[model samples]
Structures are given as structure tokens and as C-alpha cells.
Target: MRYVKYAAIRKPTEECIFCKARDEVGKERENLVLFRAKYCLVMLNLFPYNTGHLMIAPYRHVPSLEQLSDEELTELMVLTKRCLKMLREVYRPDGFNIGINIGRVAGAGFEGHVHIHIVPRWNGDTNFMPVIAGTKVIPESVLDTYDTLIKYTHLLRE
Candidate 1:
């Protein structure tokens, strides 16, 4: 809920990524976005630490968690749970790293809107490449991951 100054500067753009995805429902597949709903959308992280690094972001174009209504907060949390379910079914990951980066200094990529991250993890998933080359290995391509997740979104709301 900490208001960051930089978010104010980036709020002018009409075609914000979250807004655009909200308008285009199933087209998330084209954008590597795994799923989209009324209050939030799930999109793959272009630069991820693991294979299925996805973000659940609110549809409203606002910065900081404090800006969200109680209903919006409820929907966002629901979408977060759905994301975890989809990832569990598709990736079968042993664990997950889930959180939010609130401000620019706190590593919020899109500081204009608060989002939750759900990153799937597995045993021995990290290797020498990440340690030595500063590159994390992803077993599947973003598109493939998108396809895998999109297939499971149908059962998510249940």
C-alpha cells in the first residue's frame, strides 16, 4: 500500500498491459498470458527464475494495494488461488514462491498496479547455469506453458 512516486509518472498510458489483457479475454495465449478473469489475469514472466513463473494482477489500473476496494481484494485473492491450482495441475511443481513487490524500490515491475506472483518450484530445479552464467533454465517455452495453463483454466473457477 506504500505509494511510490514513479507509479504516478507511468499512469498516463491508455494501453497498460493489465488493461489491454482485460479487454482481450482469450488472447492471453498470444501474449503469453495464461488466464484472464473479471478482476485479474495470469501472465507468464518473460524473465523468470523457474519454468512456470506467473503473475496474478488486478484488472483495475491503480498503483498500491491501498487503492483497491475490498471486493477487488477478494477477487484478486481468488484469482491467486486459481493460479496455484492451475500450476499444480499442469507443472506438478514440488513447491511455490508466492508474493508481491509493492513499489519500484521493492521490485514492482508494473508499479502502477499491485500483483501477486506465483512461481512454481521443484527439487533440484536450479543448476550450474544459473549459478555460473546468471541464467535460469526453463524447460518449456512460454507459449507451451501458456497452452498448458490455458487448458486448465476451465476448471479453475470450480
Candidate 2:
């Protein structure tokens, strides 16, 4: 939702956006990042499949789930569950489709760094738009979704 049909603001193609966000000290809002934990962080997808599409990824820059430590894995799952609960409370989605695309062969957009995508689904959500025109019509802004998730962070326990 950052750019509506491409109006000239282009992210530098060389750097990984997620890695850049993890390293940046005070660019959370600009990066559309929602929350950060000890090992992992949650952020809105730049090109979302839905209005509230979010992703959780480790900050250590591992390329796969097997590269994660046990503690890091625990935190990732815990926070993932929490994201689901909070998203349900906020969006009241009919269902959710969550998974990790491990490699480029498996459809990983950022194949260099592993991340799990959490997409909220609703009845009649998939229309003929993408099928007919190749554009997904997300009805909300990614920043707005980021703010909504930030507000719900109050409900999460450390």
C-alpha cells in the first residue's frame, strides 16, 4: 500500500529491506514495522495479499528456519500465535492462511532471509480482480494496518 500503482518512489534494489529495517535505529514508522522482539520482528508486507497481511522474521538474518536457535524458534512461534489472536480481535477475519515460503522455488519473495507470512482471509475476499486484471485490491493502507497492530501491542505480554 506504500505506492499506488507505482508513482516513482523506488526502494534501492541492492539491499534487503527487512535487514535494513532490523539495523535501522529509528525508522520503524518509515519501514512500516509494527513490533520487535528479542529475536524476531513483525512488519506489514509492502505488497500485501490482503489488507492486514503481515510477516514475522528473525533479526539475525538467517536464511531458513533450520538456522534458528531453539529459543529464537520459540519466540517466533509465540509471537506468531499472538499476532493471530490480536488480528482476530481487530479484524475478525473468517479464517487465516499462514505459512513460510522457504526458498525461491517455494515462492519466497525475499529468499535470502526466511519469514512467515500471516494473511487474514474473509468470505468472498478473492474477487475476479486479480484473476482478470492481475492487481489485488486491498481495501486499506499498510500504514493504517501497522498503526492498528501497534495499538494492539498493548495487549501482548513481554
Candidate 1 residue-wise lDDT, 48-138, digit = tens: 6677888778888788888988988888888888778878888899999998888768877676878888889999888798669656667
Cα lDDT of candidate 2 equals 0.82
lDDT of 2 by residue, 48-136 (tens): 88877888888887779999999989988988898888889999999999999887678766678888899999999988887897688
Q: After superposition, how far is residue 39 of candidate 2 from its true place, in Å?
A: 0.5
- By TM-score, the best candidate is 2
Clashes of 1: 0
Q: What is the C-alpha RMSD of each candidate to the true structure, in Å?
A: 5.3, 3.4
